[model samples]
Each structure stands twice: as structure tokens, then as C-alpha cells.
Target: MTAGSNSISPIPVAPVGLSSRAQRFVEVDGIRVPRQDFRRHRDGWIERGIPVAEIDRAADFQDRWGGLALPPAPFYEGGPRILNAGCPKGSGAEGWSFPAGAGRVSMPYGFMIGPDGAFGIDAHRWTPLHAGTDGWVESLALAAHATRWARTVTRIRGRAVTSLDLGGYEPVPEVQGVTDTWWRGEDSLIALYRGEAVGLDAPQCLEAHVYEGLDEWGLHGG
Candidate 1:
């Protein structure tokens, strides 16, 4: 295999075989490109033959197409990672397979293995829930923040919310508190959520915020 240029890699394949782990992992370029457009790039590493399950651990199929090398993801407290989503016992890096119950918190995609039912909260796509089916909430906003690399749960108006590892990507709910939960009702795309912030005062929102207490979008490939 040869390292091409910065971010460009020419991962080679054995004439016949591969290591068990290497067989299951592929590569894709980083986040600079829109996911849908990544496939447009010609001549990548999809030919290396990564395992289906390992590919599932990545954010999108394109990521599995390249053989890019990235440092381990930076971690922070409260960044989405572990949770109480009824994950099987002893699953993931520290039992991070799912949430521990209390509410549904949006996790950045790929925080866990595969798309299997984990809530996807990418901000790249325009969400309809926060925009408007007919009338926007004219005066609404979201509030949330997360750390990287560690287990943590922040409280938005008292609601204990969880965050996941973003893999060095920018924070979701990109505008911070202004549009966090602000887009869920108007045909909006709900990201990760731990509890219902709907129909409650900030103080009351907390009373109901917990891992299991909230339920919105879930991970897709469990």
C-alpha cells in the first residue's frame, strides 16, 4: 500500500488474503464532502474487501470505500457514546452499545456499531421538523452542548441529556441551543434525544429528561 498525498491513500490488497480485522474495515474520505457526493470520487479503496459488519461501524458507505487513516477520535465527557438503549450485555467499547434508559438522546452517527437503530443527528441535512409544515415556530430555539471522549450527560432546562463521541467532527444542533430541539414538530428531523422537551417548562423539562424518558429517532442498523 502507498500513501498518496495528504488525505489521499492507495491502500493495496493482497493477491489473495487479508487479516481478519483488516478484512472487515474499509475507508472513505473525511467529512469535507457531503456524504451523498463522496461516491462521486473515483479510484478509492472499496476494492480492499472490508467486512459488512465493520463497514456498518462507519458513518456511510463512502467511508468504507477509502482506506484513509485517521487518529483515534478525541473524547470528551458527555459526547455521545455509551447509553441505555437495551444494548446486549457487554457490548461495545465500555458497554457503549446503547443508552441506559431515561430518555432518547441524539447521538452523532456511528457512535456505536452499525446503523442498527441509533439515532442519527447530522446537521448537514436540512431538517423539516424545525423549519415548518406551514407555520414555523417563529420564536423557538434549541440549547445543548457536549464534550468529546468521555461519558457525560448534560441537562437542558433540567432535562438530563446525553452526548456521544463525534469523532472530531463539529457539534450537531450546529447552532447550539437555538435549534437543538427546536425543529421536531414542523416536519422536522429529530436527531438524538433522551427525553421529551416538548410541552414542558424548562424546570419541568428536566423532571422528564432521562435516557429512557425520551424517545424520538433511533439508530438504524442494530
Candidate 2:
């Protein structure tokens, strides 16, 4: 499942969710590699009130990939730390929220990997960015892949993002969600981020990143 590997075909359309697909591999050095496994780390957190199902879900993603370096993006910086363990009884997460990872920069909150199979930010309130952690990983992989081949990469911020036209583009199902999304067109890709804005209640944080000038292989794959 590494970059350029022919084992798995390029996803033709986005999926409804990525929980079942969490086992999928990401590209690393032109080879497919499974994300780091965190089962070993789970042993230390069993008494922390993390649900078994939620723990399994978070463990499947396993935080950082061993030796797999990713580009500088707003992703998890270090590793997981059960966020709701200290909640005073009823005020805790309604369902469950296992720590996925912390952001590289200081923010009011961190990324959460559960409750269900959803991946999102935890700013005292859970704001799901993707249907599952796999979607998040898929997004990271797409960014890395697209950046390597796109001729031009553009960034749009604040109110200016509302004017862009997306007539021919289709939603990328693999990385789809209400707060954050990905779209693909004839020769380009668009990634929209509203998670920070929604999670932090900051409207000015709305933004989009466009990677254009991609070819068939870059957009999909052979």
C-alpha cells in the first residue's frame, strides 16, 4: 500500500465511511506500509475508563507510523492521551472519545478518534472531520501524493473561500465529512477545512487548499 504500489487500485469514488477500511496501508518510500500498531500501548490505559470498543478503534490507527515521515501538515504531533479520563462523572463525553493525537501546534484542543468510528477535533465538544480515521489517513496520503505531482498549489483563506466554483468536481468519499472535505475534478483536487473554525468557533479560520495541474495518475491512478 505504499506510494506507486500496484497492489490496491486507486479508489474510484469516496466511500461512505472508513472504519472498516482502517486496515488499509499508506505509501512510504514507494512501498505500502501499515500504520503503526498500538496494541502494546493499550495495556497501560485499560483502567482509564476508555471503552473496549473505543480503545480498539483508536488502537487500530496507532498514532504515528514507525519511521514513516509525513509532510508538515496540521496533524497529530506526539501520541494519544485519554482526554476524558478526568471528566467529573456526567459531564464527560456522552459516548466515548479516545485520544488520536495532539496537534503539532498549541491549540485549545486535540484530535479525537472515537465515540463511534469518527475522526475529529475535541474542543470540549467533538467536531467530526471525517467519518473514520482511515479518511484522515487517506487525506494525508492524498496531500503527499498530490503535492509531488501538482504544478501549482494554492491556498485560500477567510471569506475569499466562499467564491470558488466547484462545478465539475466530485466529493472524495474516502476523505468526506461535514467539517472537512476533499473534492476531485478533471485535473485537480480541493481540500476544505472547517474543523478548526467549527471546533474553535472561529469563523475566520475557514480555508481551502487547492492542488492543481495533476494528471490522470495523480488524480486517480493507473
Best by TM-score: 2
Tens digit per residue, CA lDDT, model 2, 81-151: 22111111112548766555445567777767656667787885678988876577667667667777899
RMSD of each: 17.7, 7.8
Error of 2 at 194 (Å): 1.0
Q: Which stretches of candidate 1 lie over 4 Å from their true place?
A: 1-5, 8-53, 56-110, 113-156, 159-222
lDDT by candidate, in order shown: 0.25, 0.60
* lDDT, candidate 1, 1-222, per-residue tens: 221223423332311232222222222211121112322222232343333333333323223222322222211113232121222222244322222222123433222221233332222221222221001111111111112111333333343333332233332232222223322221112333322233122223322111212223210100
Error of 2 at 26 (Å): 3.2
Prediction-by-prediction clash tally: 72, 8
